[model samples]
Each structure stands twice: as structure tokens, then as C-alpha cells.
Target: MTTFPQHSRNFLFTVLALVLPVLLGAATILAKTLTVSPTGKIRSVKEAVRLAQPYDTIWVNAGIYHENEITIDKPLAIIGRQQAVLDARFKKGIFSVMAENVLIAGLTLQNVEESFTKNYAAVRVRGGGHVTVRNNTILNSYYGVYLEQTDSCTVSHNLIRGNAKQESTSGNAIHLWRTDHINIVSNKVSGHRDGIYLETSSNSTITGNISQNNLRYGLHFMFSDNNSYQRNQFMRNGSGIAVMYSRNIIMTDNLFEENWGAAAYGILLKDITDGYIERNIFRQNTTGIYAEGSSRLLLKNNEFRNNGWAVRLLGSSEDLTFEQNNFIGNTFEISTSTNYSSHNTFRANYWSSYTGYDLDKDGTGDVPHKPVKLFSYLLEDIPTSVVLLRSLFIDLLELMEKVAPVLTPENVLDNEPSTRLNVWKS
Candidate 1:
């Protein structure tokens, strides 16, 4: 070990303290602001970028500028005064950022080009870190804000609306590829192929977003891990959200509602492990949650209501626990295949259809509530038989099977079913 003398260390600290402020002041002095307006000398944003230096601010005044394929290669803040518009004219991408510490805010970008072999974005940040795209409106873009191979970036408070009609041509609203530690917050996305799509990203936060009326999943992520999604609304899309091939996910306090289609689900979890899902509302979807090859997941304090099937638990899932959730007004509470082994547990949940009494005043039913109905299991094999759902003969058969516990999976039951609604607390 080498040690400095006391006077030597003190002198070194004194030198650093004297020089650091001058360097910081020099950086601040070098960062200049350039203004652009329709009537000004610098009328075009591309020309403003060409005139500006690194760490400069390009302030675009409120006007319409027809520009496309504007490449930004230096660190800069491209801010708009009011809601300045960038019209791409359906030619190419609006802003392509390849620099660090870049900020693009308070701008409306529209008419990004649609390409068969490329993804044209309103604001594309590629291979950069500490970038932010905030308070912007993206209209009719192929991809609203695309982040690729970036870290520590944020996309927040942006409204991205696309006029997408089909999945073959439309791109995602917010697309992330090979990024990490990104924050996607408070954005509204609609009419895109996917509202928010992530691929091979990790350690990110997605919260307070509205994703609806899209052609595909509202939020879709694959091979991303250690991510958290909270307080987001996913409604009336082709499907709600798809989380696949990930591990250690935290999904809580989200609303999944009215995503109605034959193949739609509130959430599709496939090949995932070690996840925590709590306090989410899954309502009026074709299926609330469909889990396949998922394991070691804790689903607690969730509400499933008025869906065709609340949960479709496949045979490959194991070690899952559904605790303190509410299942109400669903056509089928749970549906499972015949080959499904009872490797999951359901405990202390409330069921609206539960008729058992709590004789000892324990607030739990004396008899167990079987959530997986025989008819639902039959529908797994014969989906066409759902037309006979409300008939008297089907009702009698369901009644008989409930009393006998036949054909339904024996272990799939809420042993301590709550007698009342809203019994669980956060």
C-alpha cells in the first residue's frame, strides 16, 4: 500500500478544488443557445443543427418545419418553444439521434415514412445514453419513439398516436431494443401494432401509461428481466399485455379491461419464472391471464371480473400461488387442460359464486370453492360447446359436478374462500 503524506494530500485536494469550478464554468460558457423561427435567419431545423456546436440548445419557435432524416451526431438539447411541429412529409425519420445526453422535448413530429425494410420513427435515439424524449406529440408515425442500444434514457409525458390499420405495416408506438435502465412513464399510445414493445431490455420501469385500441398487444415484452410495471391502463386492444421469456418481473396496480376477442387475454405469461403480480385488475377480457410454462410466480391481491375465463392455467406451469384475489361475475373462473397437474395453490380468495357458510364466524367459508368448472375444462377440448353455456341441462350438469368434484382438477380450489368481497388489503 502506498500512502501520501498529509501535506501532499492536502495540496492535491487544494489543486482539484481550484481547477474543477473553472472547468465546469468553461463548459457552461461553451454551451450556447441557437434560435430558429420561420422569419428568423435560421429558418430550418436542419440548418440550425448544422450551425450549433456540441452541448448547445436549439430552440425552435412555434411553426411548421418540413424536414426529414435530420441526423444529430453531437450532444445537444433540441427544445421547441410551445408546440413546434416537424412535418416529415412521409419521407423518412424526423430526428435520428446518435449522441449522448440529448434531449428532445415539446415538439410535435408527424408523417414519418413507412418502409417495408426499415423502421422510421418520429424521434429515434440510437446508441446513446442519458437521452430524454419528453412532452412531445408524435402523430401518424410508424414508430413513435424508438430507442436502440441505449441506457439510462427516459420517454415520458408524450402522446403518440398512429393511424395504423394493419399489423403488417404498422410499428410499435414506443419500441425499445437492447436497452437497459430506461423509464417509460405517463405516455398515451394508440392505433399502433403494439403500444409499447421491448426486446432484450432489462432493469426498466414502465408506469402511468394508457395503451388502448391497438392492433396487437398493448404492452409486449420478451426476454426482458427485472422490470417493473405499475398503475398503467391497458384497455380495448387486440390483447392487453404479453410478457414472455422473462424472469423476476414485478407487475402491480395495472388495469386490464375490455380487451375482447377470441384470442385476447389480459396478460399472457409464457416461459417466465419468478414473477410477482399483485393488486392488478383484470376485467372484461376474453381471458384474464393465460399462463404457460410459467413457474414460481406469486399472484396476490388481484381482481378478475366479468371475463370469459379468468385464468387459463396450462399444464406446464408449476409452483404458482394465487392468494387473496377476487373472482366475480366470470363465465369461468379458471380453465385448465385435462393433463394439468395440480402444482399450484389457491388460498384465501373470494368468489362471488361461493355458497358455503362460515359457521364459526371466521369470515372464511367452511367448504372449499372449486374455481375450475367442468364445463370450462370441457371447453378446453371442445371450444364450440360454449354455445350451450346457459342451458338448463348444462346448469344441472355443472351443479352435479360441483357437488361431486368430478372431472375438474381436484387440487385447484380455494380452500379458505373469503365470505365477502374486498377482503384483501394492499
Candidate 2:
């Protein structure tokens, strides 16, 4: 055994303690690879993904790649220089990422298959976190982007659209399941079953998106809690949006327009509780706001115009406040159920149907306006009464009901109404 001197041993230990972390970091950096084109060696995208190490970047050229099921198992960034197309030819998903910290950007994904059993998406992220999907164009897929069992993902600035005629096997544009902390921002989504859907998700923020022409709700949320949706547009869908079976939600500054069906509503709240719905616009829908079995909701500063009904309450709601809203050009301002009296209050709202004269001119209506129309009560009992909507006999009956309170609920009235329209005009 050879023994070192005391001074030599001390110097060796000091050098090792100073240089060990730097050497380990250098090794980690060397493990990452950077791929570039014009090298004439990397031929295909599949070859690049296979040759990529962890934390690698595969820079693709501007061309069409006819491929399907491009599985990404390593944490790599796949970027395109120009307009790179990944055409799936209606076969399967284009990109399937199962690794964390992956980035997919500046690519056009198209022609994903429509499957009856599986959700064939253009990009499917499974069990991945910290993934960023940005600046992509996804077209004609069953689903544009599908996330399952993922967390802390960011989907931003993507254009996703599906063919509306293919309704036999339609999916959502951005479908999320059992995920959390998802940030969906500035995406244009249209022509699917639902534009954006969140199921069993929590703590997600969906903002600055445009969703239109969907067969179902534009933004559908179910069993998701503690989510916030703001500054989105929902237009020309069967139903504008629906938030169901959720609690502690916040919806602000969303636009709902032209969702005109017999049962269509600008926004539907079913079995939801403890939420804030503020500063939304509902225009030209069959119904502006529909609530059933909901409680403890605060609605403020919303605008309702050209809808069949401004608000509909189905007798199961309680502890709701409708304040500082504008109800204009609607056939009916509100409709209430005949079975039970609701515990909701409508205060300080501008109703175009208010007929009471304010003699004192204090910027408030002197007498209350009973918003529940007589025909709405008849529709509740006999659903066929909608056929006589514009008939003269129904108008006469409505006049008679106004003279004498007949079928409408006594407490369903809006008092202290605003004199001017509450138009945000933003």
C-alpha cells in the first residue's frame, strides 16, 4: 500500500470538492444534442426522434412529412423552421408524447383519423407535465389536442378546427381529462362536439380563446372545480357553453353570441355552486342564461340582448344574485318555474320591459317589473305552447295576465331597476 504525504492528500481533496459538481454538470450538458438541417445526414423526422437524447432539440425543415403515430418518449423540443406539415392521412394521432418537459412548436398538424372507439387527436399528450404546445395549426382531426392524466401544461396560440359535416364521430378541439394547472390561452377552436372540454380537472385557466360553430357547447366543463375562464368568445354553437357539476368557478368577460336553437342557451349552469359570473355578453341566443339546481352564485354586470329569454330559473336554484345587468330586446326578461318559489334576487338591473313610471326621477324605476312572462309559464306546463309564440291570441293572453296575476310567480319580479342601459361596450 502506497501512502500519500499529508500535504498532497489535502490538496487532492480540495481539488475534488471544487471540481466534482462542474464535471457532473458538463456531462449532463454533453448528453443533450442539437439537430440541424442541411447536414444531409438526418433524413426523416422519425429518425431524428429516435436519435434524439434527453433534452435534445430536433429542428425540422419546411416540408410535408407523411407520417402517423410519431411517438416521442424523450424530453425533446421539436420545432419547425417554416411551415412544416405532419399529415396523418386519417390514420391515427400525429404526435404522441409520453415524456415530460417536451415542446412542440411551429408545426401544422392535419388529417387525424376519426375513430369510434379511441379519441384520435392530432397531438395527444399522455401522462406528461411541463409540456408547451404553441404556435401550431391543427386541422380536420377528431380532436385537435387531447390531454389525459397530464398536469402543468401550457397550450397557447394554436389554431384548431374540425370538419363540421363529420358529426358521426366528433370530438373536442382541446379535450382534457383528469388534469390540473392547465393554461389554455389565445387558441381559435371551432367545429367539434365541444370546442374546449374539461372533465375531472381542477385549477385550470382557459383565457383568450375563440370557440365557434361547434355542434355542442363551445366550452363544456363537467366535474371540474376551482377553474377560471375569462376573455373567451363562444359563438354559433348548439349551446354556447355549459358549466355543470362544478364549484368555486370564475367566469369573466366571455362573449356568447348567435347560439340560436330551441333549447340553446348562452350559458347554462346546472348543479353548480359557489361561483362568480361577471361581465359576460349574451347576444342573439335562444336563452341568455339558464340555471337549474344551482346555488350561491353571484352574477354581476352582464349584458343580455336579442335572446328569447334573458334568464331562466327552473325552481331548484337558491341564493343567487343578478345585479347591474342590462336586459334588452329579449322577448322575455325572465322565466321561472311554477312548481316552487326561488330564493334568487334581481336588483338594480336595466330591463327594457319595465313599464312603471319613475315620477321622482331618481334613476330607478318606481314600480317593480314582473319579468316572468305568462307564455313562459304555459310552455312549462305544455311544451307545445312554443308553436303559438307570435300568435295574436297568445298576445291577448299575455295582456290579460299582466292585468291580473295568473300563472306567473308572485316573487319573480325585478324592482329598483336601472334607468340607463349598462353597456360596457368594450
Candidate 3:
């Protein structure tokens, strides 16, 4: 008797299968958009966050929201409209996002309270992967964006500034610890202890950033490897950039300028090996490039202009090559060890102070030019002797030392100097 209704039963089953999935898909999409507004139904950002599901987006309205310890435990997109301000003056830890696949964009985070025991930050990403933080302004915080044990994060197009007058209390603009696959691009960081500090980070790229007026080094790397820095500007910093105990690094096309101090340098390489530094510009720094305990490094096509000393190598550096570089308008071209000859080579470089003859009509100078002046070696040994830099007596002593080869290293000279200037008009 039931076999009479077989066609109706089959039609009902087909309708249920198709309609069920369509309704579920629509409900899931609707659950992903969570909006926060003062006049809307979702009153506060915290209330909107509680009602949000995974992969949801919480859009904050434009106003100052004083909150305490905002936590993001699930995958969500927190967006701010018209540069909404999130002031955490009374809060201990401002924003701690601990999940993966999170995106925080277009927000202004300011006034994150500092602590002695805890290292608080404006935005702390802990154990997150595939996170994106873009187009945000983070100011007046201990640390701008701190990444701890995270991977595959992209931080770009952000302005991070901190209080520089309070040196003991201020933190770095961007600090990365034990992270990998990080790409920090197109950011402006200033007025902190250090602009960017990377420790135990590897396989990262830092490009197109401006780091200026920091208390310490603009870019500091410690125990980091396989990292590349390109097209960044370091200006008015205490020290330009420092790389320590790192290997296989590539630093190219960067501008290190105005990092002038009593003990400062455009780039400081300490215990670094197998690195390439090319096409960089060092201008108006105390020492353009200073190396200590570095080995097997290649310095090529760089411009050292208007610096106190173009290059300074301590006795610990060995097997380094300084080739095809332009040393122009510097107080001293090279300063090296006084007693022993360095195992470094300086060939085919344009030295502005070279006055040797080119008798064979070739583009290279016929006679070798002693780059390390005796006066420079004296200044290195005795810092107070720098007062005699422009004296005629010091010039006469330098000329005599160049001809007789005394007091300074004998083999630390540029044998094949370029006849024409290696001007980088670009």
C-alpha cells in the first residue's frame, strides 16, 4: 500500500538534501560579520567579540576606547574605521592575540602602560601563524609590535613611535624573538631605544623601512641567520646597524646616514661570516663600515661619502675583500692595525685621496696608493691626536710615512686604484 507514494518520497528526499546545505552556508556567512558601534546593536567591542565566531570580523567605530587586556583567542579580523584609537592607559597588557590566521588593520594603538616585571606591548603576537598587521599606527607604547615564537607573519605599512626622552623605560619599536618567515616592510619607526631588534630570528626579510632618531642601533641583529636587509634608511641614530654572531646575511641598497657619534658607525659587523654588503650608501657617519672578527665578507659597489672614516677594520677581521667601492669625501679612507698586516684586500676601488701616476694610459693607477695615513694610525692609537688632523706638520708626517712605509702596516694599501671617480649618480 505504501508503494503507491514512492515518487513523492523520492522528491521529498531530494529537496531536503539541496535546501539543507544552502541554508547552512548562508548562516555561516552571516555569522562571520560582527560589527561594533556606539549607536548600533553591538554596543562595545568586547560585546561584539563575545558574540563573534571563528573567522569573524569585528569592525570598530572611530573613537577612543579605553580597554583593559583585550584578548583574541580565536581566528578573527579586527578592523578599525577612520583610525580608531585604542588607549590602554590603565591596562597592564593591552592587546594579546594568541591565535592563528588573525588580521588586525587600520587601528591606532597608544599609551600602553609599562611594567617592570612584565614586558608589555601594544600588540603582542604569541604562538600565531599566518598573521597580518597592516596600516596601523602604534605610538607611545613600551614595544610597538612584539612577536614571540611565531611564524609566517607579515607586518607592513605601519608607523611605530615611542617616547625617546624616557630612555630607561622605553622599548624597541619592533622586537622579534625566535620567529621565522617574517617580512617587515614599508614601516616608519622612530623615537625608541632601538628601532628593530631581531634575536634568534631566521629566514626573514626587512625592506623599505625608515628608522631614525633612536637611542641605540637602528637595526640590531643577534644570533640571527639567513636574513636579508635591503632599501632601508637609518638616520640620526646612535649607531646605524649592528650584526653580531650572524652568518649568510645580505645587506644591499640601504642608506646609512647621519649616524654620527663619538663611537658610532654606519654598519658594525661583529663575529659575522659569509655575508655580502653591496650597493649601500654611507654618508656623514663617524665610521662608514666597522668590522671586528668578521671573515669571508664581500663589500662591493658601495658608496662611502662625507664620513669621518670610510672603513675601519680591527685586527680580528680576516679574509675580507673591499672591491669596486667608491670612497669619496671622507676624512680618512682606511684605518687598520698598526703593527701587523691584515689579510684583507682592497683592490680596484676609487679612492679620492689617491695621487699616484697612470703612466701607461690605463684606467688603473700605475703606482700603489697607501690608503692608511700615518696620522690616522696615530689618531686610532691616541684619540687626542685627532686635534692635529688639519695641521701642516701632520700632513708632512703623513707624506713621509707614505713614502718610507713606517709606523703603519706595510701591505694595507690599495695597489690597483681606479684612475677615474666611481661616482654613483643615481
Candidate 4:
């Protein structure tokens, strides 16, 4: 309804001359502080916010504020002093931001009722830029922090926990829709449908976050491009992470472990292209990486340990390179739908099952290494053959398959296989 002039639109940080003695937390550092306390001139947080001007910092003291859908329609900094709690009584949302240059920090928000019709969230930002939500705790929320059409937002150092038992009735911890240039870092999320979800959101960075115990994927990205996921841990989630229909993705130094189920995978890449997945750890998952309809993948220096089917390449994969990696103690090293294809390359990787002799004193083995086993191919055709995994007859068949390459692909061999495991550097 109201818009500033062209010259004043970007002057959000211009200091005003409005003088007020605010509380001590961020008021000591803010331009102006509007104190909200039980015994102060402003008794309620809503009253303080209603009378506060732009660029003013509203400090809510350490107390419980029972508010339903407190909306911020102007540029302001609402910082809670000593982590004040805002209880929505399981009836509505706690905070909603519709303005740019808003900063919400140091608060405990709780209790947003689940509604099939309304996507009730603890904190919802609707079309804003430079919104910073940091160092807060959200509990029992339908959606902890929902950003829609926002840009340049930073959500950092927050803890979000939801009680979501079913996927159809639950929401993500942090959901971004059509947002850009956002940074999500150092957050802990648990017990949600999806811990962090991105849909059509691009140029974002997600780092140093721990997402676990979620009912769905720990981090789900669909149709999002140019995103970076680094230093994150997805443990015991329903299926770890999923990147679908995206390009130019960089995933590095993340840990995907203990995501065990018939349909679970450490990372699922479907229709993804031009991605770099390096230096990550995938352990104890049903499948370390399940790739289908993907191309131009660079997987280097990663570790896949003690998993079932370390990597599964479906029928439509091509142009993938696994270099200088370590595959240790996996039940099945590589499994493919069709005959193992030469479209992917595996060079200088260490496989624990490779019993070759480096007689030349060279670190690389003289003979080529084949990762696909006969039992894996047999299991693919008839899954009931898994019952004979440890049988001596199956061992003989696998040894015979390894002695000769009749059933496997002719060219899917690592010529320079490493005799030693590739060590990780930090």
C-alpha cells in the first residue's frame, strides 16, 4: 500500500535522528531501542512493535509472550533479550515478516498448530530481502522457518525440532520457495518431514548443518540450481539427501551415514547434471549414492564404508568419473541395472575386494580392477538369490566371474587401481 521514493528505497540502513533509550541487548549496538518489559512504559511486545518506527530495535525482555500471528510489515530489528519465549498456544503462528531488511534473533518460538488448509509456521517470511534469522530455537512447529519469494536471506545457528510422525501431515523445518542467494548455516534440525527443503530456489549455500531423525529426506532440492552443500551431516534420516532435476551443484565434505531402509540412500541424484560431489563420507547406508538419468558427475576423494551397494548406477547414467576414492567393506561395491557400462570411469580408486599383487613395487596395481561381482548381477536379476550370498557355490561363481569377464562389461575396468586406500585430508 505504501512505497518509498526511488532514492530512499535502498536507504534502509540510513540512521534516523529518533532518539530513544532502549534496553541493553542489541540496543547498545542499535540505532534506537524500543524496550518492551512487564513494568516498563511498553508492557506488551505488540504495543511496542505497533508504535516503533523503522530502523528501531524492539527488545523483548525474558518472558513468555502469548501472541498469535505477530506480523512485521516494516523494517525493524526484533531481538529477544535472554532468549524470550513466544508461545502461539498451538492455535496460530508466532511471527510473520512482510518487509525487507528484517532481523529476528535470540528467541524461542513454539507451538504452531497443524492445519491441512493453512501452512502455519513459527516464522514465515513472505517476499522480503536481506532477512536474517539467527540463533533462535523453534519447537513443535508445522514449518519452523518458511521463506517464500525472498532474496539474500541468512538463516544461521538456529535449532528447529518438530513432532512430525507422518509425511502427509507434516512440513519441512526450513522451506524455501522461489528464493535466491540464501545462506543456511550451522543449524540443527530434527523430527520433521524434510529438514531443509528447496524448490526452485537457486544460488544458495547450505553449510555446517546437522539434519537427522527426519521422516523424509534430510535435505531435498528439486529444480534448484547453482547450489552448494558443504560440511553438513545427514545421519539416520529417512533417506539422507536428494537432488533432482538440477544442475551445477557442489556437494563436499558432508557426512551421510546410518540411513538404513530398503529405499534409503546416502544421496539420490535423479536427472541431475554437471555436479561435483567430492570429499564426502557415505557409511552404513542402503546405497551410498543412487544415480539415475545423471551426467557429468565428478566424484573424487570420497569414502564409502560399510554400506550395502556403495554406488548404484541406473540405466540412464553417463559421463561420471570416480577418482582417488576409497570403497571399504561394502556389501556390494557397484550395482547397475543393465550390463556394467563404460560410460562412467573409475580411476585410481581403492577397493577392499581387489586382491591384486603390486609386484613391480608400484603403488598402483599391475592388473585392472573390476568392481561389479557376479553375485551382484545375479541378485539384480533374481533378488531371491541374496539368500545364497555367503554360500560356497556363490563364491566359486564369483571367483570364476572375476577370473574371466564374460558376464560383466568388457571396458568397465580401473586400469590404475590404487593398492593403498586414499586418505582424507581433514
Best by TM-score: 1
What's each prediction's clash count? 0, 0, 0, 0
Candidates in order, TM-scores: namely 0.97, 0.90, 0.91, 0.91
**Tens-digit lDDT track of model 3 for 36-93:** 7667888766677678897889898888877657788888889999958888884665
Whose lDDT is higher: candidate 1's or candidate 4's? Answer: 1
Please give the CA lDDT of all the candidate structures: 0.93, 0.88, 0.87, 0.89
The whole-model C-alpha lDDT of candidate 3 against the native structure comes to 0.87
Lowest-scoring 10 consecutive residues by lDDT in candidate 3? 417-426
Q: Clashing residue pairs, candidate 1? A: none
- In model 1, the worst 10-residue window by lDDT is 417-426
Please estimate how well model 1 matches the true structure, expressed as its whole-model Cα lDDT. Answer: 0.93
In Å, residue 287's CA in model 1 sits off its true spot by 0.6
Q: For residues 1-426, what per-residue lDDT tens digits would candidate 4 score against the true structure?
A: 998887786564343322233343345465578988767888776787799887789988988878878889888898888858888899978888999989999989998989899888988999878999999999999999999999999999999999999999999999999999999999999999999999999999999999999999999999999999999999999877887999999999999999999888899999999989999999999999999999999999999999999998886899999999999999999887755454899999999988887998778989888888878877778889889988999999888887776786666678899999888785
Among the numbered candidates, top lDDT falls to 1
Model 2 lDDT, full chain set: 0.88
Task: Evaluate residue 148 in candidate 2 and report its C-alpha lDDT on the 0 to 100 scale.
Answer: 90
Ranking by lDDT: 1, 4, 2, 3
As for candidate 2, its clashing pairs are none
Q: List model 1 lDDT by residue over 1-426, tens digit each.
A: 999999999999999999999998999798999999999999999999999899999999999999999999898999998869999999989999999999999999999999889899999989979999999999999999999999999999999999999899999999999999999999999999999999999999999999999999999999999999999999999977888999999999999999999789899999889989999999999999999999999999999999989999999999999999999999999899989995899998889988889999888999998888888999999989989998898889998997786788888888999987755454
lDDT of 2 by residue, 285-383 (tens): 988999999999999999998998888888999889999899988987888777858789889899887888888988889888888889988887787
lDDT of 2 at 75: 87
Candidate 4 residue-wise lDDT at 209: 97
